[model samples]
Target: MSYELQAVIGAEAVLRKVAAQQPGAVVVPLRQGFALIPMTDELFDSATDGGRGDGLRFSKLPGGFERVLADWSTAGPLGYVEAGYAGGVGTQRAALWADGDLAIGPMFVDVNEPFPAIGSPISQVLAHLGATRRRRDPDEFVAVGLDRCRDTEAWLAVDRSVLPEVARSRR
Candidate 1:
């Protein structure tokens, strides 16, 4: 099976567990498995969605693949739309900026393959926890290895914890 399909399946199981942990959240099915967003806003409009890019409703999936971050078997890059689709996916994967800004996906472009940990936006965050060195830090200063953070192919699940409660609030 395609890695994307595997991602979807994997996402389904994980998000379902997340739903149990996160009150008000439920697993909403997509073409493949499912994504987790609040259950009440299942029919939300894509145009006005602010949580992610245009939001993360499965209902907003483009009929045909528009120019998106990456191409994969059946499953696609599922992340905040504006950030993932705007111009470039930027250095950050899902960062929230002060100017009402948010970055989008490092979509599960390939689940079977390991992510490029050296210069990815996620690598930048790892630097902040004081748990590791910046990717740019001298090779000798590489505080901690990225094996724990990197080495995953799937785009991360929609982690609402990163955003404020208002961001997750229904529109």
Candidate 2:
């Protein structure tokens, strides 16, 4: 099964707010950063159905901007997970992921305005998925070149260094 994760960046003001709120979380400047979401085909399909498809959610940490980073999986058909903002409201964004050691996927430009928030519902979803909150150091995020997904077989190219860059550029 194949799954796609998206990191959306909206207005610069919103991006700045996100950075300020979660200084330690990954933050890339508008038109300069990306968001990495990982999932399987089954999970992705379920999310489209308004169900708890994958049992994972990306959440922002309390007292700062670090998102509770982790993975979530479930055994039920109705169980699912959510990542990113709720009701969408800010920043220009991009999505990235890896295939073994290669990065391949879509790099959307001029994303939708008023993107979702990284807090609230996303946090609740993460907890439901049993994800453990781990502080992702700002230096840990990196940057990489992303290509558009041509077909289902395409994989997003990513490097370990890219993770930290995603957070650093926001500052």
Overall lDDT per candidate, in order of appearance: 0.28, 0.27
* TM-score against truth, every candidate: 0.22, 0.22
How accurate locally is residue 59 in candidate 1, as Cα lDDT from 0 to 100? Answer: 29
Model 1 ranges off by over 4 Å = 1-10, 39-171
lDDT of 1 by residue, 1-171 (tens): 111111111134444553453333444432223232322333233222343323332323332212221222123222221112113222223221112222333233221344355534333322322233435654211333212112122223334244332233222
- What is the Cα-based TM-score of model 2? 0.22
Which residue runs does candidate 2 get wrong by more than 4 Å?
Answer: 1-88, 91-119, 134-155, 159-171
Residue range 123-159, candidate 2, lDDT tens digits:
3222232323335421111112222332212323344
RMSD per candidate (Å) reads 14.7, 16.3
Q: What is the lDDT of residue 73 in candidate 2?
A: 11
Which of the numbered candidates is closest to the native, going by highest TM-score? Answer: 1
